[model samples]
Target: MLVKELKKNGLQVELKVNIPAKDVTEKLNQSLIKISEDVEIEGFRKGKVPLDIVRQRFGQNALNETLDELVQSSTNEIIRDKKLKLAIKPKIDVKNFGEEKGLEYIMSLEVIPQFKTEDLKKVKLTKFVSEVDEDDYKKTLNTFSKVQQNFEKKDGKKVSVGDGVLLNLKPMYENEIVKEAQIENKMTIVGNKMMIPEIEEKIIGSKAGDKLNFVCKFPSNFPNKNIANKDVKVEIDILEVRVPKENTLDDNLAKSLGAKNLNDLKEKVKKQMQGELDNVSKMLIKKDLIDQLDKIHKISLPQGLVDYEFNNIWAKFNDDKSKGLIDDTDKNKNETVLKKEYKLIAERRVKVGLILAKIGEDNKIEVEESDLKKAIEEEIMRQPDAKDRIIKFYTENSQALASLKAPIFEQKVVDYILANIKIEEKKISKKELLKK
Candidate 1:
């Protein structure tokens, strides 16, 4: 057996391999011997077939088995000997194969790029710092208050902001009713931004039993492509209005939410808000680090890796299109345009992934079994009823276990880079931190 590197270019390699005819013959004969043990001829006892008879009967099968085993083993040996980290399985093409000629093949494959990571210490990044201020606390409390609000049926009352209304809505396009757009007993809250502004405004100030006719022009970026950017006539029948009762923050409210007292609830809310704000801050800093890394390092990406990622993205896009859940960015675009855009995204993702992996490798970072177990435990705690089932899943499913470990590994890598980089903490308002 002989292996020779034929070409090397930007994470891709081509190799030429040759196996000697004597080795091939030996392997073919060994396979034939194995086959003879299981063979039965009408004129002979089982497992007593002659070698030449077995070879004549199953010669092609033995040769094929030998060729497959030789190719696989030779490829594995070459990869291991060359220390190649393959991004995908190698493509093999048989160039020459005969009883007298032995075997010769070409193996082409994509590998992880061999490149040094940029100096983390030289990467400058800004970390936005924010805390849970009184206003943020008050805002969270207001959310809780809204969650606790009770609705009282208001017969004969006109619809108003903050009131829930049940209505039968029929949408018409071009003077024809859209059967799929007709909804009955649709409960919408006024000023909730659920309906278009114009339609919601028209619904308000209308009493029960009032039939309101209005036209709303759907936004061009609407999720549903059918009615997007089109003027639709809405015929609304206001069935009832429900007014919300004023909510007061008190001990009873706190107890209802599993808190001991109002003060305990407020403290929990502040802590939760602080944790959320910290996570947002961390995410911003991580993004900044990733962007910096992307700009500084110009490594060639593996095409196979990029294509794999793009296939996943494309599959999801097709699935969404089938469900009529296409996003505005892709709603009106042709498949070619969508593929072009998604391919760029896939390339960026693959590049970033490679960079992170390299960093993790350089820093000797790893995800421990304990870390995975803790993560699973935390997830199970979030849904205690499914604790047993979740445990069973993670234990049995290797893919699920990897999915759980991926984020943890990524975060650790980010943290390592963050520690090395010069991050300037810039104090910002909570609103600024929360901004998209």
Candidate 2:
């Protein structure tokens, strides 16, 4: 076997490789013999086929298999010998290959760029911290208890203020049906702020399968601009109704909500709300931290890596565009312009990922088995009835299992930096912390 450098650009390498004909023949013959051992020719025992006949029957297949094995081994050998850390899998362009002529191919690959880590002490980041107030806790508890509320069918009964009604809505402007604004199967508490006063009043004595047509004016600041501040013709089809079960927030209610008692329920509500807010805080700081790191580090990103990331972004963009799901701002931009702008986003994402990986490597941070176990446990808790299926999915799919490690490893790296780097915790109100 032999190797020679064809080209060496920034983080990209092209190498020419050749394998000796003698080694190729030896490997090809062995492959042929292995295949012959598995064949049972007519009037001949297995493993008893003559070499010439086996070669005649399987020479091409054996040669192709031999070349593939040789190419992979040669590629690995050169990668190891050159000490190249690949950003992606190498591509092989075979120039010439035959059992008699030996093998020749060009291996092309992008290597990870080398750079110095910026000093942590010089990088400053702020983490916003918020304390839950009594009012906020009470609001959260009320919201969660609503989630746990039980409702029973109000069969053959008239619609009431506190009843939940399943209905379809259609509104018209200038006597034209607003197809785009029509809503189906919207569940609403009759007198809730979301329901219009005139509409709710009309539905008061209506029973199941009843229809009502009326006109109502919406507020100027209505979320759906189709009917905002306008007197529009309205139609409602009441399908069913349910009345909420009245209960005090005591031990029975707490037990129904998977809590020990009323006090425990309050504590759980506050904790859950705080946990969710803390997650939001972490997310905000993480974006800022990545921006800070990006500003400090200068990396000449490999074009292949950039292209790979861009392709993923562009593919998703195209997919969303096809589904009419792209944001309003993105909708007006031309394809070429969107591609150019998104390419920069892809560049940033790739740079951030590489930096995080490098930090984790430098600090010897790793995702432990316990981390994966806890993650899997949390997933099972989310889909309690599918515990076995969830575990089996992770167990059988190596890619899915590996995907779980990426975020965990990244968060660990970020936490390490936050702990060691220059940082300050800014105390803020819950409302301030929640601001976008």
Candidate 3:
């Protein structure tokens, strides 16, 4: 066997490999003997087929299969012997293969990037701060108030927006009944088109005991794919009309939310809002920091890593489409455009990841067991069935749980950079701070 390096460019390497014809033939003969033992002819019992008969029946296919298996097994051995850290599967092109000639092939692969990270003190970042205002407090209070609102049946009046109406609704399209149900305590909201839009529109001019036959077209882009863009007629009998009664923000309302009093609830809501805003502010700062880092320390990323990142992003893109977040019509174009855009983002991520990984290694920023457990606990809290399932998942997939350590390492590196760099805090309005 002979090995020769053809090209070495950054992470990519091309190598020419050659094996002697004698050795190749010996392996092929061995494989043929194994196949002969496994296969049986009509005239012979099992494990007694002749090599000539086996070759005649299977023909060249057996040799090809044998060579394919040998190539894979040999490739693994060669890569292990060479000590190459392949980013993706190597591309193999068979240059020569014959009875007398040796097995010759060229293998191209991308290895891990080799570069020193930029100095921590060299990267500069700015952190933004936003103060909670009256508008924030008012919005939080309004949300709590809406949750505590009460409703009662109203009589001798037309149903309008914000009024909860009880009715029996039968929806039909082309004389075929699509949906039929006795809806009690159905809200007569004008904007919520998902729930009986046409009926609710007619209910505005209808009083209690009014039987309304509404001929209206369902929204062309309705969520229910089966009935979308179809003309539907709804038969609605308004049994009761109820108005929304605003409940006073008192001790009872607070107690419903597990709070002692209105003021205590308000304070809790404000604290929660502040914490959320602080996190958002931190995210904005992190983005700015990355942008600065990209501008300063730029490097060409390995194509294989970029492709892997692109696949991850594409999976998320399809997921968003399935969730009805993105329109089906825009799926193909959106995917293509996103692929290009995310390719750039993916390359940046790879660059940043490589840099952070090297930095962690150099600085000896090790991830402790406590740190991993805390991170796993945080993930578990995000899920509804946190206890058994999350623990089981982490226990089964050790490598997957270990991936959580990367983000922690990156965060520590970022923190180290922030501490060394000159980051002047900038106070801005909520509107201004949110703007890119």
Best by lDDT: 1
TM-score of 3: 0.70
Measured against the true structure, the TM-scores of the candidates, in listed sequence, are 0.71, 0.79, 0.70
lDDT of 1 by residue, 97-208 (tens): 8667899999999998889988777689888989888976898887877798777789989888999898898989977876655769977889878777878888889988
Candidate 2 lDDT, 1-436, residue by residue in tens: 7999999988889999999888888889889989999987887789999988888888888888998889988899998988989999999999988877889999999999998788877788888988778897877667665777667788898888888888898888888866645669977887776766777788888989999888877667766776688888889999988899755668888888889998898888889788988888999899889889999989989888899999998999888989989999998899889988999999998998899999999989999999999999999999999999999999999999999999999899999998887778898988898884
lDDT of 3 by residue, 211-321 (tens): 888676777566677787777777888888888878777778998989998889888988987787788788887787777777667676889889898889778877887
Q: Weakest 10 consecutive residues, lDDT, candidate 2?
A: 140-149
Put the candidates in TM-score order, highest first: 2, 1, 3
Model 3 CA deviation exceeding 4 Å by range: 9-12, 33-37, 43-45, 48-59, 98-100, 155-158, 168-198, 209-238, 255-268, 298-300, 303-347, 360-429
Alpha carbon RMSD to native, model 1: 7.8
Q: What lDDT score goes with residue 186 in model 1?
A: 73
Q: Clashes in model 1: which pairs?
A: none
